[model samples]
Target: MAVRTQVKFYYDVLSPYAWFGFEALCRYQKPWDLDLQLRPINLGKIKKESGNISPGPCADVFKGSLFFPDVQRTSEMMELPYKPLKDFEESVFIKGSLPTQKTLAACQILYPDNMEELTRQSWLGLYSHDMDMTDKGNILQFAEAAQIPDVDKLLEFSVGNEAKQQLISNTTEALESKCFGAPWFMVTNPKTGRREKFFGQDRVEMLGWVLGKEYVGHHPSQ
Candidate 1:
């Protein structure tokens, strides 16, 4: 039996870059044995701990101005579907930790297999369709759209103390691991006992290199 390389992906829905990274990972064709472990995290808490405030509000006056355009360019370059939310800065705010917490709750019940679809739909719902996932009603609607079973039960569990704690634990674990942002990846080669950390959707090629896979830049033919 071949040993599988493990890739741990830490993400939050607040970051468009994380959404891009998630899409890439989902479409990635494994050239070698691999296992992905997806962990939902709260980027706001990570930013608070790292003293990094979001630049979205003041992006026009700062280097942050380049952020969104760059993301757009990257998405185009990679041929990934992307549609920026209307009134992006004003519309896309995390009301609370409820969104991330709900992700963790869903993971607890449907993880190790169902998370990718859940996350993909969630991202598309928020960014592309302008769905307000922060609201419970919207979340249930999203669950229904994604075909997640037991919507009522999941929503109840999501707001429970255990789900909150799980989100906290994941956030703490991410911070302790020196993660300061979303779309963080930790790749481990069990056979060689080697591990590497990568941040950003841009690091996908580097990750491929680490995994001993050829980095084929995006092509129109693909």
Candidate 2:
């Protein structure tokens, strides 16, 4: 039997590209013999720790102009859903996806088995349903949608030091891996004991090379 490659997928719902990476990697997991670990990190904290204070796309005219259309194109290519909000204020800038990320960290701590579902619900809440993520009620609904047990406890823990610091720790780890963006992958080839890292959503083909698999493209059967 071939050894399973252990992969840590670091993400924040703040980036739609991370969503694409998450979805694509999950699709490749079974065929590629991967043990995918979902680590929901805080992107804002990652940037801050890395001394990266670059302005968002909305702050740049040409980048902002091409943003949503590019998002649509990528979403279509990847067969993913992405309904962007009318403005950045209600979206990524809505507390910088802080509350959602912390809640995801809580999900990781309490229900490691359900982290992916919780993460997906969080991303869909922001990018699909257009929920007001800053509101506790709306954020709670994400867990509910994910079928998380003890959601009240989940929300309670989300504000606690354990979740907050764990998220900070995850952010620190990502930066330590020299990650500059979301969907950063830390891959451990179990057989060779080699540690490798890759960035961006469009990196599955490269990852296939690392894992000794042919690139079948994202959701080829879709």
Number of the top-ranking candidate, with TM-score as the measure:
2
lDDT string for model 2 (159-178, tens) is 99999998988888898888
lDDT string for model 1 (1-222, tens) is 778778888888777888878767655636544587778887778888978666564444575678778878987876767777666655555354356456555565554365666777777777777766677777766667666666677777787777777777778888888997888988887767888888888787787777777666654126
Best by lDDT: 2
The per-residue C-alpha lDDT of model 2 at residue 104 equals 89
Give the clashing pairs for model 2.
none
Local error of candidate 1 at residue 203 (angstroms)? 0.9
Judged by whole-model lDDT over C-alpha atoms, candidate 2 comes out at 0.84
> lDDT of each structure?
0.72, 0.84
Q: Lowest lDDT 10-mer window, candidate 2?
A: 51-60
* CA-only RMSD, every prediction: 2.4, 1.7
Every model's TM-score: 0.88, 0.93
